[model samples]
Target: MEFIYSHNLTVDGREILLHIWDVPNSQEQAEDGSSEEKRIQWADSFVLVYSICDRASFNILPLKIQFIKAAKEGQSQEKVPIVIVGNKRDLHHQRVVSSEEGRLLALSLDCGFYEVSAAEAYHGALMVFHGLAKLIPDTKLALKKGTGIRGIVKTMSAVFARKRTDSL
Candidate 1:
């Protein structure tokens, strides 16, 4: 699998990091067991993305739920929000996963679910992150003091700059 694209977007002065994964097959394996764990650790919220065209991928929903449950169990009292995303809505004719199923699953898991088509530049993914950010208790305090969004961006930029400077 490869990362097709990534973008950093700011909404209401808050930063959001977006990444798109390009997997050749429905099955994804992490060469290093730590990579998946590391990603879960870094993410305070997760969006389980799936293509509506892939029927096989839909079968993995149980596994995805298990992973999320495990992650939540291992985390502190604060549970991370998990959003289920069904992409490729434009290909309705080829859709294998119906919106009802998605909704039912989300309802059962007590999470949010959305069906979108990125081909039209749908903002569903961004909305998911925005919602998660709002749900975080520290978001308002950080935004109010101007230490949350700006601080994170500044720190990230400085870290990358230092890495580049060191490599020179």
Candidate 2:
């Protein structure tokens, strides 16, 4: 199943409109027959979510990252802002993927990491998207100022690394 969620948020005194396209990783075809490649191409940023209790789902994250990166090849001016979220965090007893593992993965990917339970509390889920929203403006500013990839990465790392809280 796919869902398009639209929300407007103000970050740093600027109102930003976000249209989040949520798609499953299943092989099923869309009604319009849109391929995975097309979806990756259309995305400006990515929020890759996996269930904390599902190791197989966590294992596939690297492949998905590769797909996103490959789809973005040669687009030097475009910054890839990605966030890795471990859902079902309330199920601590059933957890297969450690929060540490998720944090390390996000550090390696140079993106934000969040562990949230959509079923337990809404705040956690909101934080994940809000964090991503905050990244976009910084990314665009970096590009506009000609700070390049290194600058963008540095800025993003600082934001995600410092503010990361292991709420699990």
Candidate 3:
């Protein structure tokens, strides 16, 4: 099951829209819009997540990271920012991946690494996003355009106009 949500977040005092998708690994669903390749392509910044308790989940990241990098083959891979996250810090007793290993992997991938427990480290989780938000360009102007009723009205009008055109 894929859990998708969008939320407005305050990162380092700046408010921004955060779109998150918790996609489980499956070959069947990996074929379309929500695929790893498409996510890497569409994302301005990426948070690639894995559970610390799941060794297989952590192991799968290298290949996903490689695929992400391969998508930017002609371009500079460093231009694409990625954050490797090890979740479930509360389950550290069952931790299969060390923080050092996560750090080293992040270093090798030329990205950032963070370990956070959604159940406990709320600030730590927020900090992870704030760290990434710092790397992104200011989206204030674009975000401003998306707010309020005017934008919604314009969107609805466009859809109606398109439908009218298609019918004729």
Candidate 4:
């Protein structure tokens, strides 16, 4: 198993980590195991992204749900937000999971749900993280203190700009 792509984004003062794994169709280990459990333990939140174009990916839904349940079970500190992301929203005609079904499943699992298009470098993923970050108590306090959203964005922008300038 290898991660095909990954991105790190900061939202409302919390680090949002996104990872996309590429696993062979023959791999049974990808479905469930101890390693998956370890990954869930490490993450503050989990967002499972499934491709609407592929029905095989839909089979992973049961595994995703199990991971969320395991996360909730193992959580001793606080509730970690779990989100089911249905990618390929641009292909509405090919949608496998309807918004209504997504909402219902999310409600049942007490998590969040969204349908987005990662093909366009989905900004919705960042927005979802931002929304979840807002729910963090420390993040909320920081925002209230005026040392929050604006400050973080400015600092991040400046840091990235400096990096780009140095590279140039």
| Number of the top-ranking candidate, with lDDT as the measure | 2
Q: Give RMSD to native, each candidate.
A: 5.5, 12.5, 5.7, 9.0
**Can you tell me which runs of candidate 1 are displaced by over 4 Å?**
1-27, 30-32, 139-168
Which ranking of candidates, highest TM-score first?
2, 3, 1, 4
- Give each model's whole-structure lDDT: 0.63, 0.73, 0.71, 0.59
Model 4 regions lying over 4 Å from their true place? 4-32, 75-77, 135-168
Model 3 alpha-carbon drift over 4 Å, by segment: 27-34, 73-78, 139-168
Candidate 3, residues 1-168: lDDT per residue as tens digits?
756456577766777776665666764245673345555544567788889999888898898778777775545545666899999998989999999889999999888899999888578778888887777667522554344444433433453343322221
Candidate 3 or 1, higher lDDT: 3
Clashing pairs in 2: none
**lDDT, candidate 4, 1-168, per-residue tens:** 544344565765555444334444345354566545554443445566667766667567766677657665665656666777778888988776677766776677777787788777758867766665554446423343433444443443453343322221
Residue pair clashes in candidate 1:
none
lDDT of 4: 0.59
Count of clashes, each model: 0, 0, 0, 0
Score residue 131 of candidate 4 by CA lDDT.
61
- Model 3 is weakest, by summed lDDT over 10 consecutive residues, at 159-168
lDDT of 3 at 83: 90
Which of the two candidates, 2 or 4, achieves a greater lDDT against the reference?
A: 2
